[model samples]
Target: DQQVKQNSPSLSVQEGRISILNCDYTNSMFDYFLWYKKYPAEGPTFLISISSIKDKNEDGRFTVFLNKSAKHLSLHIVPSQPGDSAVYFCAATNRYNNNDMRFGAGTRLTVKP
Candidate 1:
């Protein structure tokens, strides 16, 4: 079963525009949600995170929303730049224990000039 899924493997956006990335999950016990931004041949870096207790969280130019009841989450980026063109992965962790996390295949966001 796909505990976590990012149906679309890639997304494209023009510079200075808003980019939205979507993710879905099957497991309900997942309480902590995280979004990671990755570059070519590099490890993913933590972007933003929200606890299942809350519905939304924001930081600077990035924002994340979590819908516990629906088991879904999304990431939004504003004023996207060419450098923002990279892979983004939606990941989730179990609530009960610090078990391994699940990551989406990844969504490559290409911000064209």
Candidate 2:
């Protein structure tokens, strides 16, 4: 069962506030985690990623944390902007899978001005 789950299908936050997205995985063999940001009708862009050996990863205003024991991970966006409104997809796979990733339907994040 390669079920990568995002508990919430949507999240809304005010501009300049923090936005947090949560994800969980059922496969214990998944050792690589990634987060992608997508816009309508376009493919997802790689936002951030982390290996199972690491606990956290960050890039500019985005940060992702993983807890292997809990089979969970999260993405945090700081000082969210209206332009940040988009769908965020949480994905995971085993590196042995050659970076093939499975995604959650997505979490629609709306950052209001």
Supply the global lDDT for candidate 2: 0.91
Name the TM-score of candidate 2.
0.94
lDDT of 2 by residue, 1-113 (tens): 54899979999999999999999998887899899999999988999999999999998999999999999999999989998999999998865786677888789999999
| Candidate 1 local lDDT, 1-113, one digit each (tens) | 78899999989999999999999999988888888999989999988988888999999889898877788899999878899899999998997777769888889999999
- After superposition on all C-alphas, the RMSD of every candidate to the true structure, in Å, is 0.9, 1.2
lDDT of 1 at 32: 86
Computed on alpha carbons, the lDDT of every model, listed in order, comes to 0.90, 0.91
Give the clash count for model 2.
0
Question: TM-scores across all candidates?
Answer: 0.95, 0.94
